[model samples]
Target: MWSTKQLADLAGTTTKAIRYYHRAQLLDEPERGHNGYKQYRAQHLLQLLRIRRLTELGLSPASAASALENDNSSELYEALTAAERELTAAIDKFNAMREDVRGALAGRSFGDLALQLSDKPPGLSEKDFAVLLVMSRLFDAETVLTFQEILHSSPRTPVDEAFDALSPNADRKEREAVAEMLAEQTRTRTPENPPYSTRGQGLAEAVEIMEKSIAHLYNDAQIEAIRRSWELLRAQKTASDT
Candidate 1:
């Protein structure tokens, strides 16, 4: 016979837990002696040990009754298998997260441009990204990559750089120099409908989306440079017509 504290110590659980099990009917109540002191017996120890074993096997207290009555060995086995599967999944997730953390530490730029376009690349605005997604669908992956490179290079004049590097405040001399260099550069890279041009419904949407997107990022001088660049193509086409 043992007191509640003694029984708790022997069972390696708390007295409160033992009392809870008593309320749960998992542990039978001990009988009170004439001195009004209740004492726990070996039966109590056996019951608590069984409860702990079942719980360690992942059986819920509510389901313990079901476990006791039926041939739940198959259920217990299934539960253990399910627990193993969950553990495996958790490990896989941890490994992936660990790899990501390592990449971040190394600054390897693991993010995908096509998928995570709206994020990481701070140069592009939200509107710019939406249009780019359309471009991915419309253009070949190679073409899209080429365009990304082009955007990074982003033809700029010596004058534009000098002014930007010096001060944002515009000057006529610098502006003219910028315009000349831009015209020269744009003349070289103006869009020519190639054999592999992305055409049809998607093409129109892509073009429209792209135009609408960058409408604000470029200034009037930049826009003029682009128009001047297109003039060469227009002139050639006009000559052919004549």
Candidate 2:
């Protein structure tokens, strides 16, 4: 017979851990001595050691308990296999994060987003980056990469500068002209079969998120210009199909 402290020492664990196992019912309650102090036996120490070994192998306490209750080796194997998969996924996530950090240290723009693009385009404002980040989340990785390619290849023209510099109080004619130019730019630059399809189940929700992001990120004039440009593009597509 051994005291709690003595049993903990022999098992290479702490008294607190032994108490926790008692609470969890992983270890059976030992007999009490004449002084009303708990007395543990060799069986209790061996059980504690077994639990420690299973936990060190990444098994949860419940899983360790189940493994101990069952005599089947397959059950223990399955638990270890699951733990291995979880560890691998964690390792991959950390490795990707480290690469992103390395890219940031090398003076690349946009952190995780920058990693997906082949080259960073000049003149992208903070608002533009914010919108692009929102889009990246709304769409899939391949779609974002394709969009980044288009952005990199399309040089910003004087019309783009005009739209960017447009005032909130700009007249309707000025806004329309900018919209026309933008619509034409989109028509020419955008692939006939774009990577992002509107047929998905989440399309409405995704569009709502994009609209909200645009509303939050851009000025009133810029938002109006974007809306007008989209309308113009839709009209052109409709006319071409007719």
Candidate 3:
């Protein structure tokens, strides 16, 4: 027989832990002595050791109690299996995080674009990065990878700079010229058959997000130029098909 402190010391834990075990009903409450102090027995010490062992194995207090009550129970097996899977997943996640950190230290960008792209396109603006970040979440990974490849491989031109610098109140003539240039560029660069899927169950939501992003990220003239360029491309495709 010993005091609570002695039992805790023997179990390589703290008095606070012993009290917590009592509240959790994991350790049996011993009888009080003449001085009204609890007297712990060897049985209590063994029980504390067992509970600590189960908890160290990643079992919750309740699960540890359940495990103790029935050592060969299926519930204990399931708990152990779940703990193992969680630990394995956590290890993998941490390893990936470490690799990302290493890459960043070596001057590589990581995050929304990094997973799909080796590096961002030259002269990619903050607004473009924000749009790509949103797009990464909206589209599937493969689609994003394809988009990144296209952006990386396509060279920027004076027309791109003109479109970017277009004012919100730019005249229709300027917008149409920019649109025609863009449509021509798109025809030369874009594939006749796109390598990525644009149709899916989430297509409607994806389109809504893209429309909102475009409206928020670009001015009126830029948006008009984009819209006109798309229309021109469609018209050209229609004529070719016919």
Candidate 4:
């Protein structure tokens, strides 16, 4: 016979974990001795060891209990296979995220734009990065790729860089000049209709989400520039379609 602490030590686990198993009813609690101390037997040690092994094999507590109760049966095998599949999927996801982090740190462009995000762009802030991340979630892969192409191909000027640095307190003349420049630049380039724009039902919701994000991320002057440019682009696209 052994004490609870002794049994835990023998099984290479903590006394708290042993107690947890007892509370979970995974391990049977031993009866108290005449001296009023709980006496643990070899059977208890074996049960604890089995439970520990099952958990180490990636089985949850409930699954481990089920696996043990159904030992040497088809149920046990099925439980183990399910656990193995979950572990494999978790590892695959972790590896993919690891690769994305590596790509970001190395400043490498990837087919997946989310993975290629740098800590910050020279003329952009974390707000811009966050908006892109949200867009990735809301849009399909093809739409995101088209957006990336437009971003890369669009012409940049000193005015655009200055606009990125604009504050809410920017004067009216500064805002108008920036908006006019941006509108002219947007008019000269052509982009595919975004996926959201074609969704008659989803368009309003998508626009609301994107506009909210823009409001949170950009100052008044910057937001005005974007609004002005979008208006011009919409007019140009309308004319071309006619």
- For TM-score, the strongest prediction is 2
Checking candidate 2 for backbone clashes, the offending pairs are none
Q: Say which prediction, candidate 1 or candidate 2, comes out ahead on lDDT.
A: 2
In terms of lDDT, model 4 sits at 0.62
Which residue pairs does candidate 4 place in steric collision? none
lDDT of 4 by residue, 118-231 (tens): 233344334544454445445554555565555655566776687888789988888878887877765554444544332233744665555654475577778877776666
User: After superposing candidate 1, which stretches have Cα over 4 Å from the reference?
Assistant: 69-71, 83-242
Deviating ranges (above 4 Å) for candidate 3:
1-123, 199-208, 238-242
Residue pairs in collision within model 3: none
For residues 1-242, write the lDDT of model 3, one tens digit per residue: 46777566546689999999899888889999899999875456557766775565456899889877776646755765665555545665545544433443344433332433223456655555445544554665556566666666777789889988899889999999999998998778777754434435365466554655447568888888887887798789779989
- lDDT string for model 1 (1-242, tens) is 56787667545578998888778877789997788877765445555655654453344675554554454756645544544444445655545444433443344432322322123244644433433444544565555555555554565556446434433355655555555565455445544532224534464465554444344445655544434434554566567579
What C-alpha root-mean-square deviation, in Å, does candidate 1 show against the real structure? Answer: 26.6
Against the true structure, what is each candidate's TM-score?
0.33, 0.48, 0.46, 0.43
Cα displacement (angstroms), candidate 3, residue 71, comes to 40
Report clashes for each candidate as comma-separated counts. Answer: 0, 0, 0, 0
Candidate 2 vs candidate 3: the TM-score winner is 2
RMSD of 3: 21.9
lDDT of each: 0.51, 0.67, 0.66, 0.62
